[model samples]
Target: MGWIGETVDSIKSLQIRQVLTQTVSLGMIVTSALIIWKALMCITGSESPVVVVLSGSMEPGFKRGDILFLHMSTDPIRAGEIVVFNVDGREIPIVHRVIKVHERQDTGEVDVLTKGDNNYGDDRLLYAQGQLWLQRHHIMGRAVGFLPYVGWVTIIMTEKPIIKYILIGALGLLVVTSKE
Candidate 1:
């Protein structure tokens, strides 16, 4: 009876220790993710250093579910360079190639016209009413690199909220109940 009581107490203590260990590990994982995201933002000088392609407009070069790495540079934008920009009333940013660049001599401000690689006409029709060109302020970043198809996970999570919640719950359970 004495030996059994001692063993039960030890098992309870071990369970508590395991739960504490797993909690710390989970905190570390979340902290590391935030640190890495902030580091990328700093290095690229863009609020969003990465973006998922949602449209096939830039097809052949970048398909839907592709991830594009973005970089903001002080250098002037020119025709033929791919860029991401936000429209005046739209919530989503657009990725397209610069078709024309008009630089002001007095202020050095640039006005840009962009067109999707797969589209027939330029993006003027897509812009806000009466807006002819994208200004420097509207530009977010230039495409620096890409990873194909990895963004599908993000799209899936967004499209199916239930699956996302299930995955999160599973991860939490695994972390808490993990042996090592």
Candidate 2:
């Protein structure tokens, strides 16, 4: 009986140690990810260095599952450049090509008009009611490059809430079950 009790105690102690190690490791991983994200933010000069295409609005040039890399700088935006911008009352950012750029004569502020390659018309219909153009304030970043079909996972997770939960759960389980 004494030996059995000692064995059980040892098992409990080992389990506690395992759990603590996993928790600490997960915390470290999360911290490392945050640090890397901050580094990317600083290096790219963009709030979001990377973005997943949420819609097929920019199709033919960019697909819905494409992963786009963005670079933001002080350089003047040029025509034919792909960019991401937010419209008033819209939560999601849009990816489009700059078709026209009009600089304010008084303030020198640049206003841009965008269009989708696959769409029939410009994005004015998608903009907020009565808003004619997108300002610099609404611009997120200019698209530098893209990886095809890399953002499908993100799109899938967004499309189905359960998939996100399941993926997170699996990652957690992997972290916990992994032997250090």
Candidate 3:
């Protein structure tokens, strides 16, 4: 009877130890991911260091479902360069090429005109009402690097909410059931 009681107590202790260990390991993984993202933001000097191409606007050069790496530099924005920018009252960002650059004589500030590679005309129609050009503040960053077709995963998950839910559930189950 004493031997049986000792065996049960040891089993319970080992189970508790395993649970605590897994919990701590999971916490560390989440924290590490966040640290890496924040570090990228700082290194790139952009709020979002990574962006997914959603449309074929810049097709032939940048296709839909491609992943773009962005960087914000102190150097002036120039024409013929691809840039991502946000328009007033708009939530989604636009990716296009700078077609023209207008420099001010009084304030020395610059305004940029952008157009998609495949589009018929400039982006002035897409801009906010009464806005003709994109200011520096509206620009997020310029494309520095890219990975082809890598952004499809994010696009699918965004377009299909059910798949995202299932994937999240599976990952949660995997973590809970992992023995190692």
Q: What's model 2's TM-score?
A: 0.87
User: What tens-digit string does per-residue lDDT give for candidate 3 at 1-87?
Assistant: 999999778657668778788888878888999999999999999999999999899999889999999999988899999999999
Count of backbone clashes for each model? 0, 0, 0
Models 1 onward score TM values of 0.91, 0.87, 0.90
lDDT against the true structure, per candidate, is: 0.95, 0.90, 0.92
Worst 10-residue lDDT window for candidate 1 reads 10-19
CA-only RMSD, every prediction: 4.5, 3.8, 5.0
Q: Pick the candidate with the highest TM-score.
A: 1
lDDT tens per residue, model 1, 57-160: 99899999999999998999999999999999999999999999999999999999999999999999999999999999999999989899999999999999
- Per-residue lDDT of 166 in model 1: 100
Off by over 4 Å in 2: 1-16
Instruction: Tell me, by lDDT, which candidate is best.
Output: 1
For candidate 2, the 10 contiguous residues with the lowest summed lDDT are: 8-17
Candidate 1 lands at a TM-score of: 0.91
